[model samples]
Target: MFDYSEIRQVTSRDNPLVKQYIKLRDQKKYRIELGLFVLEGARLISDAISEGLRIEYAFVTEQAANKYPDTVAGLMKASIIGTYLIPSSLGDVLSATQGSQGLYCCAHTLDKISAADKMNTVGKYLVLDNLQDPGNIGTIIRAADAVGIDGIFLCGCCDIYNPKTVRSTMGSMFRVPLVDDMDYESVISLLHACGIMTFASVVDADARDIRRVHFSGGSAVVIGNEGNGLTERDASLCDQEITIKMKGNINSLNAASAASIILWEMTDEE
Candidate 1:
């Protein structure tokens, strides 16, 4: 039970917090500089709390605070600073999506582990090489979390904190371990040193069928860009090249779909 009396109301769009939320929502640089990210809706805020993320501030509309009392209570419990009540109209103005839920929060960014630290652990990993789509990145993160992937390695991928990506993750972002912005050579070295075999997902006829590949011990499956697939250098760095077999003229799967299929195969062996 939370004391609703403690919640402060913000009536002006020009309020510093409101202005800050708008900036954090739209600017990646601001997010990076501040070491914070914005999450929307009670569902995501609840997920962040469940994961024990350090929430800095919570902003809710008067209607939402009253309508979703339990959620507001949870946010209050999780918010280290305080919970704020904004007008519903202001929530609409601040939202990135249609039909805003009128619940939002700012939380500290999850700390990323170094490649060396992450690679030392024994488990399956998903590697994204220069993947550009925020939806694909988020979907892959969700899939990885679902299948119990040990970690995700992002090399030249889109910002994981992008609002679209964060929304698409649907809360899985907080549950999974992420390693971002590593170079290929460093990643390959670390993986090999830790006895983790790297498998490149490719569409070429010569690539081995994913069905036949045996996933044992530590392993990583690399998913490339949406449009270009893997670069020659990246593909060559992988210990093996594997492909999902398809019927008819279908030669490719979307990066996220491809990741899901490969993850299923890899995890099924465990």
Candidate 2:
């Protein structure tokens, strides 16, 4: 096992793993090619270990190394691990965030959901309709896991492997099977062909209150963009539109909040 604590502190800006982490953070293609995604902070690293992901590397400050010694020990066994004693200046160089938690992991990106997995969705499947915000996307993913949604379908949405999205997931990103970057038309066609009842989240007209929408076996729910809401084509594709009743002054809920509400409703709570 590599010495998690004894590894020489690296300060150079050009260290290979440091450069790779930065690239993975900034570019989409590096993440795709390496089959790796980044997870930050102590909580997410703990969660990834619990999920059995093969962590490829971890970059940590001394504080995080001490705080998560056992986790560092485990990751060191199979991974090329490095630690740095980061000053505030160096932290800014390494971290995307102002308040750096001082630790992060790179692990394999999740596998695409296969036909067998698609066929096995006997309950709720969350769908994205070109939803662009990574934070919202990540929160919805975590919510889906909490409510035991069967899988997530990312059609015409932002990349699930985006580091911001991954961080937003808070580790639930590893547990959920995510299918990404599909044609909205083909996705609708496939779901219909497979006999799944689809509910598109929309604002008005011919939509049932989410509370009243009955989700039996194998239902798919679509959540759309942060600003414009679901596209006309996406709304038209569903069997019906489902809306959360809001009596307050807010015209609409945030996409993540809306998705959580809808996923809770879709859960087979019997």
Output the number of the TM-score-best candidate: 1
Candidate 1 residues 1-270, lDDT tens each?
Answer: 335587888878898888988899899999999988898987888888888999988889877887778888888888888889888888987898998788999899997677675554568988899999999999999999999889888989888999899999999999888988677677877888888999999999899999999998889989899999999888999999999999999989999999999999999987
Taking the tens digit of each residue's C-alpha lDDT, what string does model 2 give over 1-270?
A: 334445556677787877887888888888878888777777877778778877887766766667777766665654655444444455567676668777777788766667444565465688888889988999999998898777888877777878788888988878877778567777777787788899989887457888887788778988888899988877888888888888868778999989888888888563
Query: Candidate 1: which stretches are off by over 4 Å?
Result: 1-4
Off by over 4 Å in 2: 1-6, 80-89
lDDT of 1 at 73: 88
| TM-score computed on alpha carbons, candidate 2 | 0.90
In candidate 1, position 64 carries an lDDT of: 82
